[model samples]
Target: MRVLIVGGSGYLGQFLLKYLLERPEDEVIAVGYTYADENAGPIDHPLTKIDRCRAFRVDAATGEGMDACVRAMAPLDLVVNCAAMSSPGKCEKEAELAMNLNVPTHLCRTLLEHNQKSEAIAPLLVHLSTDQVYDGESPNSVEDVNAPSPVNTYGRSKLNAELHIAENYVAGRHVSLRSSIITGSQPPLRPVSRPLFHDFIVNSLKGDEAVTFFEDEYRCPIAAVDIVAHIVALSKLAGKDAKTDWLMRYNMGGPDRLSRVDMARQTAEVLGVSDANVEAVSSASVDRGVISPADISMLSNKLNSLTLVSPMGWKDQMRLALGMAKM
Candidate 1:
């Protein structure tokens, strides 16, 4: 199988590239914009040493190098779009950038056009959406059926991207995976202004200043490994079965639902630091401009019912991530 992963230089994308290369049979092509720039942060991994894995510099946002890249990798088996300006704060600040990257209009158009020219079956497109799409009112939102009422620009843009694919693309050839806050071992190596859960925790632990976490924010944080496993399994299922059910949108939420403070305390426990190092604050304290949903813990039994990848506990995933961060 031949796979093309856009945004391969990102936090989640790096893990996806590593795991996919483990298959040995699959020829994976990872495309990222930062690869060509010298000043950009490092996206290199040990997996690049393998003969089957290759990384190319392609700007999918502008469709600069997509046509040539798509033409070269003509009959792709799977295409995963991990590219996005995912930070809610950043999206709020730069709505144009968010809409341009998140919408994925050009990328989808290129893939669909290429697939049309090929004799082989259209490649299964696996897109990553967010749990933030929900209004945050519903505790356990169902996939596809629940009407998404995103509050912020980031969520709205992501929701729009999902809607575009769901409405325009052919069924069975594509799927939009709505994921919750992804907790993973890969702590941000560079100085990230908008830190993720794991990055924020690890950075706080490594710093002298205490970090304040929102006690009201709740999410079903899944491990990066688990999410990547689901992506691979879903892709394989798409190839193995011709059923149109695989085309449907599904949420990759973990079984455990936790708050921001809970994650920080867990990280402190893992790091052998005092839980007091992390301070708890209310969502009302921040003037983020974006209205975050109180709870985006989605019920993913329907997704788990279809695939063998059962949702794992957040505590276990956090512990493993802490261990990896220390290494």
Candidate 2:
């Protein structure tokens, strides 16, 4: 299987690349962007750990290197788009850059065009989307969307891009995974997500240090491995064996849902940290303009029903991430 991953050096992408490389049949090709001038953070990122895969320098925003990406992995069996500008604050501030990087609506359109006209094998595309498309106010919101009333521009742009892709590229086999907050180990080493650093804040409290978290946001923390496992399983799920609900879309949610405060408390509880170590900060107190999803739970793991559970959850995953941070 010739598998290609865009944003292959990102938080989720690094793990996906490593796991995909484990399969003997999979010939994985990963494309990641890096700035020549910017201080490239962690040189030893998770993407660098992938054994059987190769990561190339490419920009998803401008389509600067996609043609070469396609040429390298000619006649691809599967292509997963995990690239996105998911930061609410960043996207809100830099709208054009965010739209270009966070949601590659036009890039996807280009890929769809290539898939349609190409004599080479048309690849199955799995686009990583978000449940944040909804305001997430309801306790029970399914993947079947009523209206994507995104509270933030990041969500709004992603939802719009997905809609555009669906409307324009109707012919190809594709799936849009709509899910909640993804908790994972370190994103290898990347310079992009500084404030979004998961390990530093969590472990500080767990180590009897001070911790502050927002109180306004509520979300379902899905494991990063859970999201990738579903994508891998979906890549193999054939039409005859696959169900109707699993056809073109599915939600990649987890077992329990939680607010930002509750989630931190649970982390403290799971790690046996004291309450004093955890501090509840209001969204206003936070410097970042991160949107608080009132409730971004999932409808069902109809996708997971066809697959297995990710061995790591937030607690275990966080522990591993902390270890990685130390390294």
Provide the overall lDDT of each model, using Cα atoms, as 2-decimal numbers: 0.75, 0.65
Candidate 2 lDDT, tens digit per residue, 229-288? Answer: 787787776332222344565666777666667777766666676668667777667556
Off by over 4 Å in 2: 25-51, 170-172, 188-197, 206-211, 238-247, 281-287, 308-313, 316-327
The clash count for each model shown is 0, 4
Give the TM-score (vs. native) of candidate 2.
Answer: 0.81
lDDT per residue as tens, model 1, 57-161: 666568777787778777787888888888888899999878988888877888888867775677888899999889988788887667889999999999999
User: What's every prediction's RMSD, in angstroms?
Assistant: 3.6, 4.4
Highest TM-score: which candidate?
1
State the lDDT at 6 in candidate 1. 79
Relative to the true structure, candidate 1 reaches a TM of 0.86
Candidate 1 has which clashing residue pairs, if any? none
